[model samples]
Structures are given as C-alpha cells and as structure tokens.
Target: MDLDRFTRQSETEWRVAPFGKMRVPAVIYATEDLIRDMDDKVFEQITNVAMLRGIQKAAFAMPDAHWGYGFPIGGVAAFDPDEGGVISAGGVGFDISCGMRSLHTGLTPDAIERHKSELADALYRSVPAGLGSTGKIHLDPLEMDAMLEGGARWAIERGYGRAEDLERIEEGGRMAGAEPGNVSDKAKKRQRKEMGTLGSGNHYLEVQRVTRILDQTSAAGFGLHEGDTLITIHCGSRGLGHQIGTEFLKKMAIAAAESGIELPDRELACAPINSPIGVLYLGAMRAAINCALANRQIITHLVRAAFARIFPDARLDLLYDVSHNTCKLEEHWLDGARKKLFVHRKGATRAFGPGHPELPESLRPIGQPVLIGGSMGTASYVLVGTSEGMGLAFGSACHGAGRRMSRHKAYKTWMGRQVIDELAQRGILIRSPSSRGVAEEAPGAYKEVSGVVDATDEAGLARKVARLEPVICIKG
Candidate 1:
C-alpha cells in the first residue's frame, strides 16, 4: 500500500517497474485512494505473476484488487500457449467459475412490495441454502457426468429452465473441453446434492430494484427500466470446485519442480500449458465451470417456481449469466497480430466489448452484460463492455466491491443480530440460517461499490448501465 513503491503512469494507472526475476512490469487500474487502500499482498502477487513463463503483456489488477489465496482476487494475466505458457492453479481460485446470474422479472418495485415477505419466505423454503445444504434433486454418477459435460443445456433438457435461456449464458451455458472423467470421484460426490443449492459464504439470492439508469442506450438494450425488479444469484460449483482446486494445487506444486519452472511464490503453483498435468487440470476445471452454469440454471428454475406460487402471472426472464475466476481461451489483439491466449481472471468478470463474435447475437450490439454485485445490504450495478476496455484489459472488469476486511475481523467487530437489525431498519430483508454468516458479510466489511464502479468506468474497463438496490437478500 506504499505509494512510493509504484510510479504513477497516469491518474488511474500505477506501474511497478520490472526488477529482480520479473519478466514484465505489473500494472493496476485504480484511483489514488483505492490504491492506497489496497493490501500490500496484491502488489506482491502481481509482481509474482509477471515472473511466470510466457506472460503476455503486463500482469494487471482491477480497481477492486485485494489480497486472496495466491493472486490478488481481482487479478488478470494472459499467457500465450505458443510461448510455453503455464496455467496457474492459484490464479483460478478455489471456487471455480464462481459467478453471477441476473433475472428480469416483469414487475415493478411496487408490485414486489405487495408480496415481498411471501416471496422471500417462498424462496427461502424452495431454494436450499447455507453450509452443507442439499437440493430436492440428486444426481447419480452417470447423471453427474452428464450434468458436468452438458452444463445448463443438460439442466434445461431435464426440465429445469427453458431452451431460450441458453442464449443469455456464457458459452451457451456449456464451456468447451469439459471432461467429467478428468475430475476426481471425490469432487463429483461432493457436488451430487449441491446443484440448485446456494452454498454458504458470499453466495446469495437477492431481489433488487433498478434505482437509476446510468446509460440510457445500454440500459434500453439490456431491457432495463427505472423500477423493474430483478433477482440475482451469486454462487459457484459448490464443493466440487473446491475439491478440484485443492487437489490440483498440490499436483501443480510438485510438478513445478519436475518441470524446471522457478516459482517466485510457492502458492502460485503452475504447470506448462501442454503438460499432461495441465491438460487434465483444464479438463477438470472446465467441468467445474459447467457445474456452476448448471447450478445457476437450476436455481433460476426454482426462483420462477417460487414466484409463480405468489404471482401466477409472473414472468422472470434471463438477463445474462457470467462467470468469474476462470481461465478462458480467447483471441486478443496485441501489438499487431491477434493471438490465442489463456486469459486468467480471478475475482474479475469478462467484459467482452460490442460486436465480439463470442457474444450472443441479441447482446452483440450492446456488448456482454457485466453484473457487479455489492456486499450485503448494498446496491449492485449493471455495466456493459466497451471498446476501450477491450484495448486496456483484454475485456476484463471488476467483479464487485472487493473485501476490505477479513471475515474473522468482521466477526470480532460486529454482531450478526445487530447487522441484520440495521439492514432491516433500512427496509432490506435478510434471511439466513447462520447469524454469524450475516455479520461476516456486513456491508461495512467491503469497499464502496460506487467508487469501484466509477474507477472501472474511468479506467475504461466497462460502462455502467444501471444501479440496483437490494430489496430482499437470502444469503447462504
């Protein structure tokens, strides 16, 4: 957090000059205060990332950069396979493909108020939540493999959601290269009953109301209105993702020595992209991505069913689904030529700019929807990718208001009952099995989302579309 450690490149950009063992410089996009507020671990991790093999461009961090397991949570680094690129397990995080999925309810804020409590209770009863939660539907070994391979498409085929919903999902709800066989049996078993369940810790199902439109054009394109109510689910591949990360992190750590790659940090364990171990990790990681997509799809179905029980005529359509903490093979323009690179985004969201071929046809003109969830009892934002961001960050943006304090610190300083009561006083409803969980996610435990989004836009990572205030929050 020492400003003297970095040289100012511009108002929003800070540079760490490449030195000892670093292959490239590290760059961070943030305002002066945000940078000063950032944890020192972030700078250390970014510099470590720069020393990795085949690193293309500078290792970068978004405005929400904060200390994480290995890399800074809001980290972005691309590596070229042709240049002996290495795929890092730490860069992907433990909860693989953890993401946000937003739904558009065809009702206004006033309509939600009429049956808010009923809807909240209904959702709580219908959607399994909290630690070790299980859903009504269970997957057998064969069915689990199918779900991991087919993703949301398989869930839709099994009557979870509509066929049309796939259009709004990333990779059409199924990431390529998913090999269920590559995943460990233990990992698959852990996820057997977790689908459609919102596992604890940062995962939640929130109902929000659009309070303001920041960009009329993009907001219109995204089917947004001032008072429209929306529901957003934030989760990941449950225990399966965690198991894969734990298993592979150890494998990569051992392989790093065998492969003759010097690691600046042991936590940044990695393997060559073409190595056998790396290939297996990619296959297993892709399966985890599909698991997350399928999980969100099933949760969306449960949300619709819960809403129907309250409002018979209610219609909740998919807005967009995006995953963070992923390493995607994407084509990015660098220097003068287009190169295929494995872009690792940890605690960051992909913000593919307008007209990118990877986007769905309907959203191509406006670019991909970037869902930015705020902390508990806070307001979230919707943003769209911009051409400027594509040029700057390989079309990447901040995922949320990154954590400002540790969970342990929060529990020591605040009480769950007080936090819940304070939020309730502000007309925000909170429902959770664990009172301590609520305190750990207190709004004060995170950086200001508005400032993060403003810095993101100022740095040309993404353009804000609409701001949404939480009406009901069902945290895990």
Candidate 2:
C-alpha cells in the first residue's frame, strides 16, 4: 500500500524489486488510493508467486488485486513447462472457472421499465439461486460426463441455447483436453442437479441499462448502445468446482515435496507440470471449465424462457462469456522466440487483443470483451482488449471491483434488510433467499468499480466501451 515500498515504472505501473527468495520481480497496475487501501497481504502473496519455479517475466497483479489464499486474488503469472514449471491448485480458488457472461436483449430501458417489477419477479422465480439451490433438470452419470466433455455445445445439442452462441464464448464454449474420467465421482454427484443453478457468494443475474459509451467504435462493434437493456449472468461450476478444488489442493500439497517443489507457503500447494498429480488436476480442471460453460449456457436458456413468458418478442443473444481462475496454455513471444507457457489468471479476466487467432472472426477487428462485474447495486462496465495489453500481464485485466472488506466484516457492519430497502429506494430491485447472504455482499464492502476500470484502461489492460447500471438483481 505504501508507495514507498515500490518503484514507479509508469503512471499506472509500479514495480517491487525482488529480494530474499524471489525469482522474479513483482508488478502491479493500480492508482495510489486503491493500492493504499489494499491489504498488505497482497504484496506478500504476489512476492510468493514470484518465487515459484519456472516463472516467466514478473508476477503481476491487476488494479483489483486483493489478499487471497496462495496467490493474490488478482494475480497473473506464467510458467514455462520446458523449464519445469508447476501448477498450483491454490492459484485457482474454490470456485473454479467462476466468471461473468453478458447477454444482449433487443430491447430498451424504457421497454423494461414498463414491467420492471413483473420482470424481476419472473427472473427470480425462473432462475434457481442462493445457497444449496437445485434445478428441475438433473443429469445421470453418462449424461453428466457428456456435459463435462461437451460444455456449452452439449447444452445446445440438448436445445438449451442456439448453435450460433458458441462463437461468442471462450474456447468455442468447450475446452479441449477435458477428460471427464479424471473428475471424481463425488464432484459429479454434487453437480448432478445443479445444472442451471446460480451458486451463492458474489454471483447474481442482473438486468442492466447501458448508461454511457466511452468508445463509440468499440461499442458499436460490441452491439452495445446507450439505454440498451442487457442481462448479465455471474456464476460458475457450482458444487463440482468446489469439490475439485478441495480434493486437489490436498493432493497437491502432499505431492509438492515429492515433485521437488519448495513452496514458501503451504497454501500454495503445487505439482510439477509433468507430474501425474498435475496431469490429473488439469484434466479435472478443464472438465470443470466445461461444466461452468454449460451451466451458463443453460441459464441463458432459462433467462430467455423467463423473458419470453413475460414478453414473447424479447430476444436475448449472447454477447460474450469468459472464465477467470484458469491456467491456460498460450503462446507468447518472450525475448525473441515464441514460447508456450501456462498462464494462471486467478480472479483476472483474459483480454485477448485484436487480430489474435483465438478470437472469433467477427470480433477479430475489435478485440475480446472483458466483462468487469460490479458489486451489488453498482454499475458494471464492458471493456475491449487492446494489443498493448497482450504485452502487459499476458493479456490480463481486472475482473471486478474486488472486495474491500471481508464478508464477516460486512455482515457485522450492515443488515441485509436495510441494504435492500436502501437500494430499492434508488429504483434497484433486489431479490435473494437469504438476508445474511445479502448482508455479506453489501455494495459498500467493495471498492469503487469505476475507479478500478479507469485504472485498467489507463494501464492499457483494456479499453472501456460502455457502462451498465443495474436495474434488477437476482442474488445468490
């Protein structure tokens, strides 16, 4: 937090020179105030990340960086497999592939306002949310494995979403190399009935209106316009992700020593890139990524159905869907030669730039959409990736406002009913099954999202296209 601790590299870049066990330097992109308010543990965790084996470049943190288990929540680090790189379960939190998805509904804010209350109630009723929520759709063993392997493509084949929607999602909505056999039976059981459910803790479905457009060219490319009503889904691979993370974190811890990894912290449990434990974890993790993609695809169908019941003419189209908390194998030209590295982005969004082969043809000229979700009752933003970003932090950007306070601290300071009532007075509708959960997600507990986005844009991580203000929220 103390600017004195780091050397200024540029307006939005700060460098922490490596000392003591660090193998690389640490870089953070944030304004002074955000860094000042950040917990000191972020510095320690990021420094720890620099000490990992086979680290390429510097360990980096985005503007929304915060204290987290093992690596900082907004951490970014890449390792070369050829250099004996390792994968850490702690790098990917409990909620594997947890990310945000935005939908473009062919409607205006005025049209939505005409029946806002009814629409809110309909969405809340149709979308299963909150803790331990289950859906009507269930999956058997064979079907479960199929979904894991097929991802959103499987959901589309089952008539959940349109076939064209796959192009808007990362990895064509189905990550390759996903082996369902690597997923444990216990994890599958937990997700059997949670196919279309929104798990609790920072997850929600919101109806938003584009309040502003920062870049007209990019906004038009993204099919976003002022006052357009958008539906945003924020969730992940329900119980399955948590189960995989839980099971593997323990295995990785025991396997670390055998893999000859000298971890500075036990929480950063890891295994060599080629180790059996690492291979199995990757397989299971990729499958979990598919589960998250399929889950969102099904939820998109549910949203369309709910809206269709109220306004049959309303058309909800996929904008883009990307996952955080992943270790993706990508090639980047480092020092002169192109090298394949495993880039771990925990609580950070991938902002692939224009002309990148990974992007869809329609979006190749513009860039990938980096959805930055705001806290409850706040305004989220849509930013486009920039070529400059690919050189910084490996095309990574801040995912959200990031928590300013702990959940326990938030609950002790505010009551859920009171927070809900205040937001309602501002014309924002809030619905959740648990008041305690609501209190834990109070908007005041987070940093100002606008500032984080500003820092991100200033740092060249992404370019802001439009801003979305929440009109209704289905909380989990």
Candidate 3:
C-alpha cells in the first residue's frame, strides 16, 4: 500500500521492480487513492506470484486488487507449458468459474414497480438461496457425471433454457477436456441437489434497472436502454468446486515437494503442467466449470418461470455470461510470435477485445461484455473489452468493487435490519433467508464500484457501456 515501494508508470499504473527470486516485475492497475487504500498483503502475494515458475511477462493486479490465498484476488498471470509452467489451485480460487450472467427483460421500470413486491416474493420462493440450500432436481451419480461433462448444454437438453443461450455463454455452454472420472464421489455428492441454487456469500439474483448509458453504440449492441429492466445472476459451482479445490491443493503441494519445486508460499501449491497431478486437476477443474455453467442455466429457467407468473408478456433473453476464476489454455502473441499459454485469472475477468474470433458474430465488433457486479443496493456497470486491453495484463480486468473490509468487520459495523430498512427507504427491496447474511454483505463493506470501473476504463482494461441500479435483490 506504500506508494514509495512502486514506480509510477502512468496515472493508473504502478510497477514494483523485481527483487529477490522474482522472474518478472509486479504491476498493479489502480488510481492513486485506490492503491493507498489497499492492504499490504496484496503487495506480498503478488510478488510471490512473480516468483512462481514459468510466469510470463509480469504478475498483474487489477484496480480492485486485494489480499487472497496465493495470488492477489485480482491477479493475472500466464505461463508456457514448455517452460515448465505450473498449474496452481490457489491461483484459481475455491469457487471455480464464479461469474456473472445478465438477461434482458424487455420491460420498463414502471412495469416492474406495479408488481415489484409480488415478483420479489415469487423469485424468493422459486430460487433456493442462502447457505446449504438445495433444489428440487437431484442428480444421481450417472446424471452428475453427464452434467459435469455437458455443462449448460446438458441443462438445455433437460429443458432448463433455450438453445440460443449457448452463443451468449463462454465456451458455448460446454467446456471441453472435462473428465468426470477425475471428480471425486464426495464432490459429486455435494452437488447432487445444488444445481439451480444460489449458495451463500456474495451470490444473488437481482432485478436491476438500466439507469444510464455511457456509450450509445456499445449499449445498443448489448441491448441496453435507459429505463429498461434487466436481471443479473451471480454465482458459481457450489460444494463441488470447494471440494475439488481442497483436494487438489493438498495433492499439488505434495507433488510439488516430491518434484523439487520450491514455492514462495505454502498456499501457492502447484504442479508442473505436464505432471500427472496437474493434468488431473485441470480435468476436475474443467468439470467444475461445467457445473457452474449448468447451475446458472437452470437458475435462468427458474427466473423465467417466476417472471411468467407475474408478467406473462415479459421476455427474458440472455445477454452475456463470463467467469472470473479458473486457469484456461489460450493463445496470445508474446514478443512478436504467437505462443500457447495457460492463463490463470483469480478474481479477474477475461476482457477479450474487438475482432477476437471467440466472440459471437453479433458482438464481434463491440467486443466481450464485461459485467462488473457491485454490493447489494449499489450500482453495477456494463463495460466492453477494448483493443488496448488485449496487450495489458493478458486481456484481464477486475471482477468487482473488491472487498474493502472483512465480512466479520462489516457484520460488526451494521445490523441486518438497519441495513435493510435504509435500502428500503431508497426504493430498493431486499429479500433473504438470513438477516445475518444481509449484515455481512452490507454495501459499505465494499469499495465504490464507480471508482473501480473508472480506474479500469482509464487503464484501458475495459470501456464503460451502461450503469444498472438494483431494484430488487434476492440475497444469499
């Protein structure tokens, strides 16, 4: 957090020169104020990531950078397999493929206000939320393996959503290279009834109103307009992802020790990309990604059903869905030649710029939609990837208004009832099973989301498109 420790590269760029054992420099993208407010642990963790084997370029942190397990929460790093690059469990975080999904309602705020309370109750009753929540669909061992391999596509085949939604999701709703055999029985058991459920802590299903458009062209391309109503779902693989991460971290640590790899931190446990353990972890991790995609797809079905009961004429269409956690094999041009690298993005979003072949044809000229979720009752923004961002931090950007304080601290600072009442006075409705969960996710616990988005835009990580304000939040 000390400014003296870094050399200023620009208004939003700060560099920490490589010191001992570091393979490259460490870079953080943030405004001066944002950096000053960060914890010192962010500095230590990012520097530790720089020392990891086969790291390409520099270890980079986003505007919302904060202290996390091994890499900083908003860390980005790429490594080449031929250079002995390692796959790390900590670098991908426990909630594999945690991400955001937005939908178009094709209605105005007036239409929602008429049935706001009823719609809120309908959604609350329809979608299972909070800790240890379970859904009606319980998958058997065979079905679980099928879901793990097929992802959202499996959900669609089961009548969860429309076929058109696949184009809007990452990996066409199904991640390849997933090996269900790599997933443990215990992990599969934990997820049997978790599909279509939003688990606790920072996950929610919210009805938001488009309040402003920053870029008319991009906003139109994304089907956004002021006064239009929208829905956004934020969640990921539930207990299954946690179990896989836990199991793999231990396996990787032992493998690393046996292989004579020196880790800067115990939490940075990893295995060589060619190693058996690493390959197994990737297979399991990819399955977890599919679980998350299928989970979100099922939730979208529930949301559509809930809306039909309230407004039969309402239409819900997929916009874009992107994950912030996981390590993915990708191709990037490094130094003058194209190279294959495995990019690890922990609490970071992939901001692929315009003209990238991976994007859908309709959005190719506009680039990928970068959904920035805010705390409950706060404003979320829609941003587009910029060409300039492709060369910065391996086409990665911040995930959200990173936590400014611990959840415990926030709970101690404000009571749940008081927070709910305050938000209600501002016309925002909050519905949740746990008042304690509401207290822990108090909006004040996070940094100003606008400021984080502004820094991201200034740093060329993404371009702002539109702003959305929460009208109804189903907290978990």
Local distance difference test scores for all models: 0.93, 0.93, 0.94
Off by over 4 Å in 1: none
Candidate 3 residue 35 Cα shift, in angstroms, is: 0.6
Model 3 worst lDDT run, 10 consecutive residues:
251-260
The digit string of per-residue lDDT tens for model 2 on 367-472 reads: 9999999999999999999999999999999999988789999999999999999999999999999999999999999888999999999999999999999999
- Winner on lDDT between 2 and 3 is 3
Runs of candidate 2 exceeding 4 Å displacement: none
Q: Write the per-residue lDDT of candidate 1 for residues 1-476, one digit (tens) a residue.
A: 99999999888889999999888889999999999999899999999999999998889999999887678899999999889898988899999999999999989778889988888899999899998679988999999999999999999999999999999999999998999999999999888889899999899999999999999999999999999999999999998999999999999999998777889889999988888998999999999999999999999999999999888887789999999899989999999899999999999999999999999999999999999999989999999999889988799999999888899999988999999899889989898999999989999998899999999988899999999999999999
Quality of model 1 by C-alpha lDDT: 0.93
Model 1 TM-score (2 dp):
0.99
The TM-score that candidate 3 achieves is 0.99
Clashes of each: 0, 0, 0
